[model samples]
Target chain A: MIHLYQNNGYNIVLDVNSGSVHVVDKAAYDVIGALEEQNEFHTPDTLKSPETAAYLKERLGQEYAEEDLTDILEAAAELAGQGRLFTRDVYGDFIDEVKQRKTVVKALCLHIAHDCNLACKYCFAEEGEYHGRRALMSYEVGKKALDFLIANSGKRRNLEVDFFGGEPLMNWQVVKDLVAYGREQEKLHGKHFRFTLTTNGVLLNDEVQEFVNKEMDNVVLSLDGRKEVNDRMRPFRSGKGSYELIVPKFQKLAESRNQQKYYIRGTFTRNNLDFSNDVLHFAELGFKQISIEPVVGEDTDPYAIRREDLPRIFEEYDKLAKIMVDREKSGRGFTFFHFMIDLEGGPCVAKRLSGCGSGTEYLAVTPWGDLYPCHQFVGQEEFLMGNVEEGLTRPDIGDAFRGCSVYSKEGCKKCFARFYCSGGCMANSYKFHHSINDTYEVSCEMERKRVECAIMIKAALADA
Target chain B: MKHIKTLNTQTLNNTVKKGGCGECQTSCQSACKTSCTVGNQTCENRK
Candidate 1:
C-alpha cells in the first residue's frame, strides 16, 4: 500500500509494506494518482489511459509535455510491478504464517499488588486495585507465574516478567522474592529472565530504590511533570499531591542507574495543552530517558483530551520537536521515548502488522493468579484467559487477540501511519468503542500528527 | 521501486534545519505508548 501526504511543501509517498519513502514532483504525483485510480478499476493491460493522461495534464497545469507524462506513467507502472507503489495483498504470506504459528506466552505482567497509595483521577485500574478487591500476589502465585512463563515460552531463550500494580512497591517483598525465584528458575530452565518494575514512587525508600536499581532490567518511574500538574491529576486518596514525595527519590534513582534502562514516564491531560514544557522540565531535571503520553479514558471526563484540543496538541508536539532538535545541537541530547523512531532500522512488516504482541506472546497475571491478555484487560473478566494453575482456559480469547492486526482493521489498513501506530491501543478500542478492531479516533489523529512531526524532524536532521 | 514525489521547494527551503540521527538503542516494546510494562525485543536482533 502507498500513502501520500504533504510535508514541508514536499509530496511524500510512503510504500507501507516495503518501507520506502519517496519525494516526487507535482507532475509525477498527479500522474501516479491518476494511474492508481485507473489501476483500481481496470486490469494492467488497459491501465494506461489517454483520456486520464490528458485530464491530469490539464489538471496539473500541463507542467510536463505529453511525452514526459507518458514516461512518468511508465515509470509508475514499473514501480507497481516491483511491488513498491499501490501494492495489494502484501500480507498473504504473513497471514498464513500467523495461522500456523503456535501461541506462546513470552512475557507476563504480574499484578504484584492490588492496592495503590495514590488515587489518580484517570486511573484505569480503578486507582490501581483494578476496581475489585485489594490484594497482593502471594509468593506461590508469583512462582507459579514464573513457571508458567518458562513452561509455555517454547524455544524462546529470553522471557520477561513485569511487577505491575496499584503500586508494585506496596508488595515489595513478593516482588523481591519473585526476582530471586526467577533467577533460580533461569538456571534450571536454561532461559534468561528480564524483570521490569513500574511504580508511582510513593513507597520508594532508599532500600527499595537500591534493590530495583540493581535487579530490575528496566524501571518505569511514574511522575506527571511539574508539582501542580501532577498533584491536580494524581493525588492520594487524602487529596494530597505526590510530586513532592516522588521527585527526589526518582532523581536519585535515575542518577544511580548509570547504564541501566529506565524512563521517567508522565501523562498529559487537557489541562496541560502545552505539555511540551513538562517534557522540557524532565530534561532539565537530568532525565536522560523521558516519555510523556496523553491520558486515556472516557471522552466525557473534563480532563480528557477532547477533539478541540488537537490543534494545540499538535503545536505542542512541534514545540517539543524544536526543543529536542536544539538539545541535540547543543550536545545535550535526551531520548523522548515517543519521538524515537527506528527510521534506518524499524521492525519488520510482520511485527508492525501484528503490533505489541499482547495476548499471543504476553499476558498479565492478577494478584489472585488470574490471567488476561495485558494490564489493560486485567479486571475485565470476559477477557480472562485463565489462572496460572489452569493454563489458558480461554484459548479462544488468545486466538482472537492473535488474529487482530492493522491488516484486519478497516480504518488502519488505509492509514499512512498504520505501520508506526499498529492500529492503536486495543484496550482503548474495547473501552471506548466496545470492539478491539475499532480505533479511538482522537488517539488516531494525535498519532498522525506525531508521525508528521517525526517526519519533519527526520528530514530536518538529515538535511543538517 | 525508486520514485520521486514532488518537492515543495519554497516550503522545503523555509523549513528549519537540524543535524544528527538521534536514534536510541532501546527496544521498541519499551517505548510503546501502551501501559504494558513489557516490550518487544525481536527487532533488537536485527539491529
Candidate 2:
C-alpha cells in the first residue's frame, strides 16, 4: 500500500511495504493518486490500460500535458514493479508465520502500590488504586509476577518489568525485594531482567535515588513543568503544589545518572497550550531525556484537549522543533521523545503492522495479581487476561489484541502516517470508542503534525 | 540502501493542499465523531 500527503508545502508519498518516503512534484503526486484510486475501484491486474491513461489525463490534464502524464504513469508503474506502490497481500505470509508461533509475555508492568500520595486530576488510575480499591502489591505477588514473566518468555533472553503505581515508592520495601528476587531468578534461569520504575518523585530521597541509579535500568520521573502549571495539575492530597518538593530531587537524580536511560515525563492539558515552554524548562533544569505527552481523558473535563486547542498545540510543536534545532546548533542537544524517529532504521513491516505489543508481548499486573493489557486497562474487567497463577486464562482476548493492526483498520490503510503511528493507542481506542482497531481523530491530527515537523527538522539539519 | 529525497526550496514553494479531516468544513466535534466512526463495523468483526 501507499500513502500520500502534503507536509510543509511539499508533496510526500510513503510506500508502506518498501519503507520508502519520496518527495514528489505535483504532477507525480496526482498520477500516483489516480493510480491508487483506480486500484481501489478495480483489481491490481487491470491497473495498466490505455483507458487508465486517458482517465488520468482527463483528471490531471490541466496541470500536465499528455506526454508528461504518460511519463508519470510509466514511472509510477515502475515503482509498482519494484514493490513500492500497489503492494497488496504483502502481510499474508507474515501473518501465517506469526499465527503458528507461541504468544509470550516479554514485558510486565507491576503495580507496586495501588495507592498514591498525590492527587493528579488527570491520573488514569483514578489517583493510583484504579478507582476500585486502595492496596499495595505484596512481595509474594511481585515475586510470582517475575516468575510468570520468566516462564512464559519462550527463549527470550532479556525481559522487562516496570515498577509502576500511583507511587511505587509507597511500597519501597517490596520493590527492593522484587529486584533482588529478579536477580536470583536471572542467575537460575540464565535470562536477563531489566527493571524500570515510574515515580511521582514525592518519595524520591537519597536512598531511593541511590537504589534507582545503581539497580534500575531506567527511571521515569513525573514532573509537569513550571511550578504553577505542575502544581495546579499535580497537587498533593493536602492541596499544595509538588513542584518545589520534587524538582530538586528530580534534578539530583538526573544529575546522578549522567548517561543513563531516564525521562522527565510531563503531561500537557488544555490549560498549558504553550507546552513548549515546559519542555524548555526541563531542558534548562539539566534533563537530557524528556517526554511531554498530552493528557488523556474525556472531553467533558475542563482540562482535556478540546478541538479549539489544536491550532495552539500545533504552534507549540513548531516552537518545540525550533528549540530542538537551536539546542543542536549550540552543541547541547536533548532528546525529545516525540521527535526521535529512526527513519534510517525503521521497524520491520511486521512490527509496524502489529502496533505496540500490548496484549501479546506485554501485560500489566494489578496489586492483587489480576492481569490486563497494559497499565491503562488495569481496572477494566473486560480487558482482564489472567493472573500470575492462572497464566493467561483469556487467550481469546490476547488473540483479539494481537489481530489488531493497521491492516485491520480501514482508515489507517490509506494514511501517510500509517507506518509511523500504526493505528494509535489501543487503550485510547477502547476508552473512547470501545474498539481496539478504532483510532482517535485528535491523536491522528497531533501525530501527523509531529511527523511533519520532524521531517522539516531533518530537512533543515541536512541542509545545515 | 534506499534513497530518500528531502523537500527542497522549489518543492516547498508549491501550493499546499489539505486532505482527510484537515479539509473538513464541519465543527471539530462533529467531524471527529464522523471520521472516527468510519470503520466501526469492520472493527467489530475483528473483535
Candidate 3:
C-alpha cells in the first residue's frame, strides 16, 4: 500500500511497508483515494481542511496557472501522509532513490575524421593553425570504444553512438563499421540504439546518404543561408568558394528518401546579422526544421553579434516556423520546430537547464581518444574529462565537475533566469574567459530576451 | 536456539555486503538538462 503527501509543491507517495516514497501523478493519487474510500472503515468520512479547499481553488483556477495541476496532485500526497500510509523512512530515502534513477551516458563520441573537405570560417575546429594538423580516427579506436560502451551497460537506458568531427563521413568506412558493431551490441543488450551525425554536406554521396537514411536517427546538416553569404563564410581549403559544391549536395540529400530525418543548421555572422531576409530565404529551401546560432568572437571583435539583435532574428525564425507548421498542417508531410518548447516543459533528455550537459551526460572523444567535456574543447586541456581507455572511474574528475556549479554560480544564483539558464555552457565560459570559474551573465541575458520573444509568440497565437 | 539462528545469519552476511544503486556513480542527467543555454550563437546561424 502507498500513501501520498504534498510537500514543497511536490507530489510525494509513501510506501506502507518499507516507508520508501515515490512521486506520483494526479491519476495515481485519485486511484488511491478511490481505493481508500471503498474501504470505508480505513479512512474517515469527514473531509480535511487543506486538501478539500485547495483542490477546489486549484481546479477552478487551472486556466490561470499552467502549474496549478501540479498543486492539486500534491494535495493527494498530503492526504496519504496524514492517513499514516507510510513510515518515516519512505520520505527520507525518496531523494536518494530519485538520484539513483537518473540517466547516464553509456557511449562516447567517435570522431571518424578530423579533416573537412569544405572549411567554414567561423568553425572553432578550423580556427587559426589547428586546421592544418587534422587527423582521421582509425577503425581500431571505433571498435574499442564500441566495446567499452557495450561492456558498461548497467546504468544507461539508451545507448547513442554519435559520429562528429571535422566531418564524420569524411572517412565513411569507420562509420559503417561502428554502426554495424553498435547494432550487434544492441542485439546483445536488448537496449535501443540511437545514432546522430553532424556534418558539412560536401562529402555526403549516394551510398553515404543511403547508409545515413537506413542507420542514423538524426542528421544535422550545415547550411549558411543564401549563395553569396554561404560562399563568403564557408570556402574550400584552397580559399575557393564552396557554395556551389555544397548546394548541389544539399539538393541531392534533400531529394533522397532520407531527407525527412535531416535538420538544417546555420551559423549567423556579423556580416549576416542584418539579413533577416537571408533567414527567410534559408527557410524557403524547404527543409522542415532549422536552427540558427550566432557567431562567437572576441569581445572586441567586430564579427561578434550581440544578444540585442534577437528580436529581429526571432521575427525571422518565427516566420520560418509558421511556414513549416503550416506546411505540416496542410498534409505536406511532417516538420518539427527546432526549439521544442512544449516537449521541454518537464525534464527533457535533449537539454539541461543551463546548456547541454557537456561534462557529465555527454563526453566528446577526440580522434586520438582523448576525452573532453565536449567537442568544443577538442584542443583545450582544461575540459579533458578522462581518456577513453582509462575510462570515467576516477574520483578527481567527478569531484572537480561537482564543485563547478550549474546553478550556484555567484551571478546565476541572483539572476531571474537561473532556473532556465543554469549558468550557460561551462566550456564556453572557460575558453573565452581563460577561467573555468566565471558567471554566465551574457548567456542568461540572451535567454531572458529569448523568453520575451517566446511570450510574444504565445500571446499572438493564444486565440489561434 | 534464537542465538544460533542470529549467528547463522551473521555468518551468511559475511559472503555478501550491502551495496547502493550501482558501481557507476551519478546517473542523473539533471546536470545536463540544466546546463543548456537556449541561444547557442554557434547554432543560431543554422536557422
Instruction: Tell me, by DockQ, which candidate is best.
Output: 1
Kept native contacts, as fractions per model, are: 0.12, 0.05, 0.10
Pairs that collide in candidate 1 are: A23-B4, A23-B5, A24-B4, A24-B5, A24-B6, A25-B5, A25-B6, B29-B39, B29-B40
Worst 10 residues of 1 chain A by lDDT: A38-47
Candidate 3 local lDDT, A299-409, one digit each (tens): 666656556665666565555445544444555533322333321122221122323445555666777676766666667765566666877654455344434544345
lDDT of 1 by residue, A1-464 (tens): 56666655656666555455556766677766666565543333343556665655775545667766777766666655555556554564556465446756778888999999999998889887786999999999999999998999887777878888889989999999999999999999899888888889988888997888778888888998988888999999999898888899898999999724998999999998889989989988899999898888687888988888899998898788877876787788888777766554455455555566777787899998999888889889899899999898998988888777777778786777776777777888888888887888888888887776666656555545
TM-score of 2: 0.82
Candidate scoring better on TM-score of 1 and 3: 1
Could you tally the backbone clashes for each prediction? 9, 0, 41
Better of 2 and 3 by DockQ: 3
Off by over 4 Å in 1: A8-11, A23-56, A61-83, B1-42
lDDT of 2 at A454: 71
Please identify model 3 stretches exceeding 4 Å from their true place: A1-103, A127-132, A255-259, A307-338, A343-345, A348-355, A393-395, A403-406, A414-416, A437-440, B1-47
If ranked by DockQ, best first, what sequence of candidates would result?
A: 1, 3, 2
Comparing 1 and 2 by TM-score, which wins? 1
The C-alpha local distance difference test score for the whole of candidate 1 amounts to: 0.74
TM-score of model 2's chain A, to 2 decimals?
A: 0.88
Alpha carbon lDDT at A175, candidate 1: 93
Evaluated on the second chain alone, the candidates' TM-scores are 0.15, 0.14, 0.15
Root mean square deviation (Cα) for candidate 2: 9.0
